[model samples]
Target: MMLETAFTPFYSLAGGALIGLAAVLLMLTTGRIMGATGILAGILQPTSLPDWSWRAVVLLGMISGPGAVLLITGQLPAVQVPVSTIMLVIGGFIVGVGVTFSSGCTSGHGVCGMARLSPRSIVATLTFMITTAITVYLIRHVIGV
Candidate 1:
């Protein structure tokens, strides 16, 4: 939970401001929150064929923006995770399925929806958080994984 010195308080504030701005802008422009998983799921729907070019661009930026920043700065921090590649892929797939079933991702429900005080979003976000906490506890303690 601790940010490195390279990620100063100013950087953290700026990043948060950018996220807030992006979410606000997206809501104002498209009546949609900037949630990656929801957008990705929307792209996957076969019936949604009314110019998803913007969605594609947003997704591409989500994927490449960090890399672009690293390229510009010539310095990228290493990400350390204990899980294997297969576990990571499986986890991602499970998360995608969960988000689809829940009708929104954490960013959508937990951030934007909560800001608007949506009851369904509050329930969904709480459920997601509780489930995640229990799963982590079971994995780290019961299963020792």
Candidate 2:
């Protein structure tokens, strides 16, 4: 099958700008890193009610984008999963392990950390990019999946 890549340059740029703004706002308001995994983890076992509340709010806001789209456009945005459920589960497990080992997710390292010129975040972000490239090559070209 041909890989269908949607080149939505304007949408991508707007989405990226919004994400950057959210990261900046989170840092400015809470002095917290905008790592999705970290936020989820905090909600799972938050140290305090306020911590849990903010994490929950962040998670809700992340999910509510689709609802907002539905309200404005009369439908949710199209989402396509290019892999099987098993593959998705395995990929999620691998990502969980990577996050645990790396101590931060892409939003933390790639967006915030690199923006701050953090050495560890720089290395982590590079590793993430290289691994992502290799993974896509293997999946699409080598495995033809």
Candidate 3:
């Protein structure tokens, strides 16, 4: 919790605001939804990319932000995964399935859809939140995993 007391609420809030701004700007500029799953899915398709340039640029921009910060500060965020590679892969697969079944990832429904007052998104977001809470409860409390 609190990244072991190293977390700063200021940075977290600012980071969230920046993400929201990026999502809004991307939508306004490109008329495309800014969902990571949707983007990845588009790239994975066999057909030629409709607008490969912007897709590559968006992906690169997302990557470069962290690289730029690392270069300037000579530090990366403290990240720790308390699971093995196999577990990580499994978790990722499960998340992909959920995204597919839900027709969108968290950002799609939680941020964009909710902002637009979509009823489907409202239900999807609520379902996702509740499921996440229950999973965490089981893992951390009951299962103690």
Candidate 4:
């Protein structure tokens, strides 16, 4: 069966390109790798003023990026988070633990690390994709979410 989906290819491609550009820009600007988990962890740990300063700035920029888009476009595409609050919290905890266990998050492995041609990142990204597929299948099909 042909899957005729309502996917906006333009926005998806643009967003992907932007993410790649941002990753490259971060590398060129600062020699540090642009890994969100690493950035947040670094912020949590004791470090010199300059070291954490950049992390804080990057994290804040990430947080504000959507707001900037909303201001420019005057609307954000509809996004419905279907999970309940308790499930959301639990999922967050699971993600946190996974990041810690994996030593990086999706941005780190899937985007930046893949750009850098790291084997571990390739493996991590594959694992993430597979696990996500399984989880989504279980939630939507099996459990009938």
Candidate lDDT (C-alpha), each: 0.79, 0.90, 0.80, 0.86
RMSD of 4: 3.2
Instruction: Give the C-alpha miss distance for residue 120 in model 1, angstroms.
Output: 0.9
Name the better of 3 and 4 by TM-score: 4
Candidate 2 local lDDT, 27-131, one digit each (tens):
899999998878988888789999899999999999999999899989989888778899889999999889878878889888989999999999999999999
Best by lDDT: 2
Error of 4 at 139 (Å): 1.4
Of models 2 and 4, which has the larger TM-score? 2
Q: Of 1 and 4, which scores higher on TM-score? A: 4
TM-scores across all candidates? Answer: 0.81, 0.92, 0.87, 0.91
Best by TM-score: 2
By TM-score, rank the candidates, best first. Answer: 2, 4, 3, 1
Clashes of each: 0, 0, 0, 0
Off by over 4 Å in 3: 1-7
Q: Which 10 successive residues of model 4 have the least lDDT summed? A: 1-10
lDDT of 4 by residue, 54-118 (tens): 99999999988878889999986565677778888999999989998898888899889888899
Worst 10 residues of 3 by lDDT: 1-10
Q: Point out the higher-scoring one by lDDT: 1 or 2.
A: 2
The TM-score, computed over Cα atoms with residue i paired to residue i, of candidate 4 is 0.91
Preferred candidate (lDDT higher): 1 or 4: 4
